[model samples]
Target chain A: MPLPSSIAALTAALSKLPGIGPRSAERIALHLVQSESGAVSQLADAIVAARVKVHLCTTCGALTEISPCEICASPRRDASLVCVVERPVDILSVDKGGTFHGKFHVLGGKISPLDGVEPEDLRIAELEARLQAEPIQELIIALGTDVEGDATSYYLAKRLARAGLKITRIAHGLPAGTGLEFADELTLSRALEGRRELS
Target chain B: MPLPSSIAALTAALSKLPGIGPRSAERIALHLVQSESGAVSQLADAIVAARVKVHLCTTCGALTEISPCEICASPRRDASLVCVVERPVDILSVDKGGTFHGKFHVLGGKISPLDGVEPEDLRIAELEARLQAEPIQELIIALGTDVEGDATSYYLAKRLARAGLKITRIAHGLPAGTGLEFADELTLSRALEGRRELS
Candidate 1:
């Protein structure tokens, strides 16, 4: 027999998540229904609370409970250097490295013609406005190394070059933990081209 | 830096669910916070609705929207037979076979002394009560193949055998899609011992 309407609804909602599929969604829904009501209610409340309270930082488009966010509001961070990323989650990825102390600007998404996403659809206008307002010395593009990322980077570099701003892209090379043998031809070639002199 | 309070709360709650780890929970929480308020609210509502509405059947302990559940309340099922399982989720596994037309009895959990779960902690008393009230002719033990499952099955069989009921356990053999080459030694031995005689 089919599951009850409530259970079915929970499963359908869970299936809309990023990684969860129909079977895993069903399992999670069943577990939640069978669990203590207090715990399930707490989870529901948490979900709603997060959605309601958390929003994008007006200054950088990073997710935050505050308008400017901690990073953008901080005076200690390098305001002259801005790292541009595609999404707010990418800020976390960059933060995990613990190297960059520069401020960030979220582009919201990349320029993907196949997906009907254009430059106007992203936060490029906001980025241009930030450049004009903030005393930014360098613009670091920390986007993906895919076709869309390359196209977006090229488009931005061409558009912003006239403003006499120093633009750079994060280097593409073999990842830190991986060996040369594991590196793809494109990565190996890029690493070779971007080789630095010994300190 | 740590995530915002609301995002952290949502991540913690999501991580409490089965199969979702810290990373997956973080991803889902971020996705929900970034999603439209209406969609997130719908998911939250679904969770609360399922938890508040779905409850255990009084007669069989199966999760249901009603008291007795669809299986126990239905008259078309074989009243003389009942399949016993460790959890309510196990009922779905048995139902997938589509051969068993009998009702089900959920034991809540298997007997595990190390974890402090005893026979009394399960729905064994409920099963006994059903045996006395219902016209059950056979008690099928569809528990797991592990040590806890074996102990629970043995204890139940011994305790309920005095009621003059035919007790049986599901056969252990090679799985349908697999070959003997993939079967382990114990499974091969059990399959050989339980070989049937064709008419």
Candidate 2:
């Protein structure tokens, strides 16, 4: 009457993943079942291996096979500058730009009262410890422009203001290749507020 | 400079799955790395378990935990009528209609010379063996309406004509919930040719 129990179980498990819907999960499950056993086994082994080996860097909370992560361990990186992000994945977005040569600090999540995520729930304590231990000159908050991200940024700014560090948020503006008509009012307002002199 | 070797390996492995592109694979890999170890472990275990537990039904070639599968083992189904399909997943689509109570025969794939899929490459021999063994009266070809499907259907019809069994294909027409404007010329032509008169 229904899909086989094993297939149904696999579909349910796949549906729990981000970006995977019920239909997509069912398709993937069916594909896996129909695929070669060796390929499926390899996928399973890869997942398990990644889960077992990858872990959050103790120094910056970024995902890494090593405790400190390569970024934290690299002496060439600017230790004086620390970029704070919401999750380990956010680090990849920043890293891909190849602009910043500083170290990173993953907050694990934003300060969302609705989601019951407070500042203490994040890796703020580890950040504070790093601030005290490292000669950090600036803290760049590279968080989302949402309400939660704003609240978290504001909270971090206030908490770390006494530490005599230069705190700044990434400038918001019309995205590249997007016209003014496509820009939302909030983004336009932020662009106006963050306008710099082009002499 | 690049992602950790383990993370990259997981991403590559995930990308190999159907419907999962490189970007989606990367996102899933990153999510797994960030997720609780228990949850990732569960997904891995589920994949392996499904791969290990599920096998092709010996009687009909459908995926099932059992060798014969429920459909093949059940006596309630019309054993005299066999519905031929391209893949095991196609059986699910037919079964969902809840109209056909006949047994299913998965050919694994259609005849595609371009793809190097021949009749011998499919489960045609097994189907012929079933025809000789079972009290099959009629065979319904429920394959896709593609060129390859038509070729396969024609081939099977010729091969099985000597057996004196009635062979019919599922009709092609304008799909439900679609307007004539959306119907292709070939489909419209088929619908016109297959039109029936009201009594």
Candidate 3:
């Protein structure tokens, strides 16, 4: 039998989320209906509250409740060493990795030529505008090893080059805690070429 | 860096669901926050609507918008035979299987001695009351092949047996579409013991 209309609506809405599939959506919908009203209300309130309160950080394009976001507004994070990423969500990954002590710039998306994503479609202009105003000494391109990512990084490095400004890309190699045997040939090549001399 | 307070709160709430992990929760929270306000509001509305509209079926304890539930009130289904299951959610699984055109009784839970669950803790009284009122000729126990499930099935069969009422447990064996090579020994043994002779 078909689920009741309201439960079906909940399942439909939940299945539209990033990782949830149809079966998972149904399970979650059923579970939610069975749960306490207070819990369900809290979940609903959280979704609504987050949507109402959160927005892109005006300065860096990261998600934030405030205009500048905590990273850009903070005094301890290195303002002169900025990491550039392809999407707003990537900002969270790098920050949560606990090693990057710099601010971030979200490019919104890569310049995928096949997908018609051009340089102008990205937030490169905003980065340039930030450069003109801020004291960023270096730009770390943390986009991945895809063709569009590489092209975007190179395009940014060339377009944003200035006197006393250094631009670098994150390393491509076998991931940490993984073996060399499973590393793809392209990644192995990149790892070999980007090898550094241990002091 | 930690997520913004609102996003963190949303992530915490989502991770409490059945299959969502902390990483998945964080990913979903980020995606939801970045999504369009209208889409987010629709999802919130769906959750709230489901919570507000749905409730347990007064008769069989299934999740439903109305008290009797669709199956319990349906005229086409066979009301003479009743199926018993552990939880209200199990009713959905059985009904959706497209077989066994019978009424249903939710036992609420199995008889688990280790977990301190007795017959009194279940909805056996309700099932008995329904038996007295309804013309239930057979009671199909669709609980699983677990030890507690078997114990509960046997207990119900003994307790509810009468001059005309027939109590039957669903089969246990290698699941359909599965090979015997991967089937555990107990499942294989059960399949062997329960084998039927084709005419």
Q: Say which docking band candidate 1 falls in.
A: high
Candidates 1 and 2 compared: the better one by lDDT is 1
Writing each residue's lDDT as its tens digit, candidate 1 over A93-188 gives 998889999999999999998999989999999999999999998999999998999999999999877466799999988898989999889889
**What is candidate 1's CA lDDT for residue A69?**
97
lDDT of 3 by residue, A16-92 (tens): 99899999999999899889999999999998898889898889999889888888999999999999998888887
How far residue B171's Cα lies from its native spot in candidate 3, in Å, is 1.9
- Tell me how far the alpha carbon of residue B54 in candidate 3 is from the true structure, in angstroms, after superposition: 1.7
User: All models: lDDT?
Assistant: 0.93, 0.92, 0.90
By TM-score, the best candidate is 2
lDDT, ranked from best to worst: 1, 2, 3
Fraction of true interface contacts that also occur in model 2:
0.76
Per DockQ, the best of the predicted structures is 1
Chain B TM-scores across candidates: 0.94, 0.95, 0.96
lDDT of 3 at A157: 85
